[model samples]
Target: MPGPLRWLLFAVVLTALPVTAGVLVLGEGEPDTAPPETAAPAYSSTPLGDLDTATVALARAPFCDRIPEEAVAEALDGKVGPTASYDAGQAAELAPGIKDVAHEHGCRIAGPGGTEVRAWVFVPPVTRDRATDLVTEAAGREGCSRATAPAYGDPSVALLCPSGKRTWVSFRGLFGDAWLACSLSAPSRLAEQELLDRTGRWCVAVAQAASVVE
Candidate 1:
């Protein structure tokens, strides 16, 4: 379950309370259908070069800061804001199942105004079905609802959940073998189009920078 402070930090809301029966917990809505197919990334099947564990760990650290300033400006229609990132240790606490992504990475970008945007990354060096399973499990948590958005990669999925004073979007997709999960949130006043754009555009850079294939 997502803690109260985590909800504030991510601007999330709880719509579907968890119904626990034994060890099982289910969300109010079923996971959205698998994301639409897209061009697979090369690294999806190919091995990530000499980028060893230490190197990959360093690359993922401070990932929120990794997205270039220019990319964020373009995503928000030139509305730029300071960005911050967190590793899996912190990312997992932000919400339930965020760490489900392999090599899970995280970031939070202040909305140029009142909204905030966060993105998560998963590297899975596996076939499409394996990637789909990961995506399904990540979004199946309680309080999340499947949403319609451009699939970020092969076998991807997206969802929307409540955020305090905002709407939060959760998107996870398999690009080749890399699975990515991202969330965009903004004050109710912010247009939904902008949030969608942020998730769609920023994810491109994430896909580009991702080094973990499994």
Candidate 2:
């Protein structure tokens, strides 16, 4: 399937899935449970102050490299896989206007047991206001809603968008002139609250790692 079509289909599957008390649909067969070994890492809800002045040089490297492998492993409770680079071409195909305002670069990090996290950095020339507008539009999309906890960065926002049996949880914030976001699809069978808690920690880890990137 084409990239856009595949994503659209995924979104449709997410919206169609039922979210019942204590259980969120994942797929056929019994709902899977999260083992204690894979529990969410401890985190602080405090926002990272340095993001207000941090900067990223995308021309020098992809954003994913800046995130520590150990942090990623602990956040998702899984082994980290090779990082895949997302280029401007893919961004244009998904959202054309993205290229006009800033240079877009992203990384998709795969975790053990099929879980995945994706992070992006929109290089300078993209203002905080524009970033806020983009994040608001995304949060308002069907099956997507705002997440109020575990916030970080200046003018930050978080969202949870259910897709099929899993939920896509993300955190985004504007740091200086750049926009950064981290998103992940939670493992199936975990309770709704557990899922949210895990995603929140994942966002915090990504933000903490991003904050130190010069």
Winning model by TM-score: 2
Worst lDDT run of 10 residues, candidate 2, spans: 93-102
Question: For model 2, what is the alpha-carbon lDDT of residue 155?
Answer: 68
Candidate 1 matches the true fold with a TM-score of 0.53
Best by lDDT: 2
Segments in model 1 whose C-alpha atoms lie over 4 Å from true places: 1-66, 74-82, 87-103, 112-114, 123-127, 211-214
Candidate 2 per-residue lDDT, tens place, 1-214, comes to 7999999999887876655422543344575586566767764442333233234222322545666666677556787876666655454322212333225666667777667777766654467788778777877877788876544455677777777777777777676666767777766577766666666666655655555444
Mind giving the per-residue lDDT tens digits that candidate 1 earns over 45-158?
A: 111121122223223323555566666655555576776555654434455333432256676677555656667664335578788687778678667777666555667676
Model 1 CA lDDT for position 125: 51
Clash pairs, candidate 2, are 14-163, 14-164, 26-165
Clashes of each: 11, 3
Could you report the Cα RMSD, in angstroms, for every candidate shown?
29.5, 27.2
lDDT of 2: 0.62
